[model samples]
Target: MTKEQQAQLSQQGVEALDKLLKETVENRVLPATYFGVTGPEGELYYSCAGEKVFGKPEAGQVDPETTVQLFSMTKFVTSLAALQLVEQGKIAVDDPSVIEKHLPELWAQSIITGWTDDGEPQLVPRKNPLTLRHLLTHTSGLGYAFLRPDVLERYEKKEGLKGFLEANIGVEGYVRPLLFEPGTHYAYGTGVDWAGILVMRLTGQTLDEYFHEHIFGPLGIGKEEITFLPTEQVKERLQSMAARTSATKGHIILHPGWRNVAKMTPEMIGLQSGGAGMVGTLRAYLKFLAGILKCQQPGGIISPQTFELVFSDQMPEGKQPRKDLADFLEFMGVTDKQQTEGKVTHSLGLCYLANGSDDGPLPGSARWSGVAKTHYFVDPKAGIAAICGTNIMEEVPTQFLEVYSKFQRTVYDNLVQSKL
Candidate 1:
């Protein structure tokens, strides 16, 4: 397509996405939402809707400049930092001894077998050594206590341990018994946090500092735009988080958990929580995603070989972990009708779809989401990256999901499919 034709189609796509975002906010599907799309060069489209604070007209509308909690989206940055270390030959993803040397505490964790008759936890030593690959792939056997309520109850009631949020007392907060043996299955949990710790131990730099010197510095992103600790200025623009009273309520109230978390001092939130700690503006995040998309070509952030590995499936072949990875994709609802065990796999830091359908991202795409309903995807085959940012807590509502899916489809239908 000619440049003029392409620009016209892109503008049409932006209008469609803008209409969707505005409608979602008008219908109270979300208190605030922002969406952006980029290619290897730079941004293709951007839009936002709703107020920064729910039910408060004076709070102003959320825009690309609004800072919001990134939650687990922080994993993508953490994983990239760890991968950079690998490129420098400071660490190896496949080597267990490197992890053992750097983060011995994580390597020494035991697998939880079952509960004894007395309600005590039964534990067994791990047979396979922990590796960076296992941690990055979510196959390290660590998982959140909330996901396993029996374990949570045993730890909190029987053993008198604090809950996950209450236990935000540094790296120790994530230290728990393994849910399965290392390299045996996929369980999303504290593995990325451990990887962050490994990066800190080896480089002697906090995640924030390391990112500033490396990732942000190279991309020209300011410290105020994206950070583990928001400045006073960034805090002023921070978007309020909300939760639906019920799916039927169709409206949002300030999320109770957000209020508690907002009150936490840095001392209270001791660890940087590489898995879910950072906050940033949508504009800055889109730049970062665009840089990642550039990695598909020459002269990118990391070496082309390293980028290939980062996007490739790291799971072992003919293993139960691959099956577990397939189950994870299905559970996340990212798979199409053509999805099968062989077609879906876990890349270093994202879910890889070997045969993505035309309705969404193309084949050879990597995607993931945050706990607060934020979503992003990088499609190498399509040469595009996109993000949908929101501040809603709890499970994603069906209305929001439908809108998000439509936004992605509209993006491809105009920017990609039209070019074909």
Candidate 2:
């Protein structure tokens, strides 16, 4: 679609999207809103809960402008920041010497580690040094065990979770222990967080500062309600966010002070995390994606080359697709299996699923769902994108996957059926 049409898609897509909103709201999910932009073949979006959200633009509301916490979707932004640093020769994607310059503690604390083929744990002397590339690709062997019992115990005692977050709000504290040797496996822990710290160190800027100077600064976002703003300033924004969280009321684990927006505490490190933090409107978020989707050259928020790298498969070599697929499904509770035993069916790091050998979200669509059920899709080949956000979490939230899959399929079929 032309630029004019793309802009219009937000207006046009909303009609259908509004239908989606009602369906969600009527289910008794909390207040929800979507600020999405649809390009011909790509989209960028962010969501926030607002008073009477996405229902109608309220007076002085600027609903589309207010920023909402992106949670893990910030990984995409964090990834972009790292790639930008690489583009400027400020950081090497795979250099170990740079590791010490930025994080001296991690240089010593982490023992090279991995898992054995027998499903037993193993350790190895890291053959190669960890680099920015390793972290961004999530192949740096870092792991988070909070999801498991024995592992969480070992991780907390050895790594110290609160201590970890305190020291390495972004990178400094997180770089401590290597869960495994660099490049040997993909565990998807604080590697991206480390990347955020790397951006800070290389650019001599804080995470928020770097994002504004390099990213948000260019996008003309934050035009309405502020996102990635400090907690002290988020009362209005938090109230907005609190509105959309109806689905996960019982099950979703959120930032502690989320309930009493007025009583939130401040953190020392207000860094924008690559793994899970950043607030934005769905429209602003989609604008970000549209630039990438339509990028024909080296520079548009991120260099095109770097964009390719971020989206490429980052898992370690050689594993059954079913193993990872099951991992992804199990993470979403779509299966009765565990990650190790699951199939290698999907891509990691916010990219599209590979059709799960004809069983997943189609062949060339990349999607990510937030902890709160905010989801966005990028369809490069098909020229389609969709975003759905609700304040509540589903008991079996994965069900929405089928709902969205059908939406995409409908779009595809309707197009073809018309041609026929």
Candidate 3:
């Protein structure tokens, strides 16, 4: 944090990013990329690279205002909403009965025991109760089918299960059986979507309304910056989704999801998935993150106590991701080293990975990404929150990870320049 260190970091950051930017133009990771960095003090850096849409020369380039589908990054916003409710004392983070009391329909849930002898679905009653804490920490036993296809197979057997890609957003998509008993496992799932529903049920305001009234409005954000469902106007500002074509070259190709997203109608707005249904500009979303970072200080979105709780470890007591689960997650493009990494854990509101000890992300830092390669990390100790995003389908492809890894190292190296 010294002036000399800041100057060195700035130089190193530019050098590292310059190489990555060239690769981006060469289609190394994405066709379009937008990124921002902030701290409790304010904006640090913001930049964009590549075209707005692949193969559309006349379209445009990315910028701070260019909007992109946040995908699972929406969970950060939903987490904030839930934590706000906790700050208000309307909901208890640790109360097991809070979920059942507000959303009784979830009471009849079952855990996926195993497949039956005839390939039928096997189910068992969950012994432990689902709590607000469980939902916030992803210990509530809910999951997304796209990530874990094994659960998707079981969910497909149920009648009336619709693909949410172009369909209406609803809790029905997440109403499937639990992957394990509540409070027993660490799985990335739709618990936050349910938490969003809890916010609506308690406040009688839609998640959109609740965020605007509480988080956005108080923080001085406009409605245009963050749109849950892509309206026509929102669609206009969106950086088109680029599909990855090759592993080595990061070849640029157009994907159908971009067209589908462009044509999203108002009807698709129903039942917002607090887990995935949201889109916004990089600067706007960074502002929201700045709010979370500011919460580490006094006079922010939530109380300081709540902020500490949000960033602290919330994993099952003395438990980590099972080896099989960690393998499955890594295979799905999410990095998990719970088995090999020392004392790995998750926070209540964010996916707290490693306690940064030696190198890389500082200890107790929280981070997560979207399906389309959008990623963000907040290091409270480092006084830095960085967001790097590209409208590329599939999460953290190898080439993208290479670029991301370099960016992350440069950021941390600059912050702690003495390491060099």
Candidate 4:
């Protein structure tokens, strides 16, 4: 089809997406939402609707350029940095002892079996040495406190462990022992954050600086467009994030306290969290995704060989997020019965979920999301990328997932219709 014809057809399908977004806001599913889809042949469409902050008229409407905290989505970039190092021969993912070269403290790491009857934290020797691959696959024993209550208690009771969220991601912060042996299972944790520290040690550059000099700068994204530290002007464009809460009477209510968790203060100025700690606009992040999708060809940031590693699965055979973990997530309302019933896996840098139907994206299509309700997916075989964002503090509630799923399905339906 002609380029003009392609654009016309894509626009037609976007109209359905546009209507769905409008209706979602009208129903108060979320205070605001921004989404973009770029694809198979470079077509693009995006929209923003509803108030920027729930019940805060002074905050104004969300726009295409507004920045939101990336939260866990930062993992993709951190993995990208490590993969680039692997591509350059500076690091090897398969080496079990690789992380020790940068962070020696891990050499003596132990696994937490549980507490003793006397109330002492019980520990055991690690069976297998930790590897860079283990960290990338989340098979390395690390975990987050929000998800692991044991870790939260450990962090709180540990002496001199202030700034747990703000600035404690150094050798001192690597205090938690392994939940299990390395490479045995998957638990989302600070493996990527340590990977970020490794990147800084290997390159002698900060994570933010390395991203700009290598990935963002090469793709024409302004240095200031996406950052861990937002300047005054960029800060103005940051939408206030809210935690989803039960409705008051008949109205949807949101708690804004979660916004503080994402803030970067002076104390945290130097700490770069590979697992979380990133902020960017939907437009800028989409550009990053486009670069990831395009870099497989010549003249891109990394060579095709390296790009393949990014999208391909790195998990060991039959090893993925533990079923019990999924059960706990379902209990906490983080995932539904359908999602927990199926296996959860991860690629080098993204989450590997099920394939779309015969008419949708390819079987290997990969995606991941941030804590504050931001999500993105790239279909390599179909040459399509779509992302949706909101500043809401937690995972999309089950009811909202219905809307998000519909939006995703609509995007694919439009892609198929355009082909016809």
Highest TM-score among the candidates is held by which one? 1
TM-score of candidate 4 to 2 decimals: 0.89
Tens digits of per-residue lDDT for model 1, 184-272: 78787888988888888888998989988889879888998988776667778888888874563655788744334445555666667
**Candidate 1 vs candidate 2: which has greater lDDT?**
1
lDDT on C-alpha atoms for all candidate structures: 0.77, 0.53, 0.72, 0.71
What RMSD value applies to candidate 3?
A: 3.5
Candidate 4 or 3, higher lDDT: 3
Candidate 3 local accuracy as lDDT? 0.72
Task: Provide the RMSD of all predictions against the true structure, rounded to 1 decimal.
Answer: 2.9, 6.1, 3.5, 3.2
Superposed model 3: Cα runs more than 4 Å off: 1-12, 164-166, 245-250, 320-329, 334-342, 357-359, 416-420
Q: How much lDDT does candidate 4 score?
A: 0.71
Count residue pairs with overlapping backbones in model 3.
Answer: 2
TM-score, candidate 2, is 0.74
TM-score, every prediction: 0.92, 0.74, 0.89, 0.89
Give a tens-digit lDDT track for model 4, residues 1-420. Answer: 333333222555779988989988888877688878875345478888878668787769888877777888889889989889998898898876577777777657788787777667687898787888878878788877767776545644653454335554555665567788887777878888888888988999988899999988987778667887666667777777666554443345556543353355535554777777777887888878877777758778788887777667667655345454455445545443434664545677876544432324456777777877787888777677878777775443665556667777788777743444
* Model 2 spans with C-alpha error above 4 angstroms: 4-15, 29-37, 40-62, 112-125, 157-176, 223-226, 231-233, 239-262, 265-272, 320-322, 334-349, 354-364, 392-396, 399-420
Order of candidates by TM-score, top first?
Answer: 1, 3, 4, 2
**Which residue runs of candidate 1 sit more than 4 Å off their true CA positions?**
1-9, 163-168, 245-250, 256-261, 329-342, 416-420
Clashing pairs in 1: none
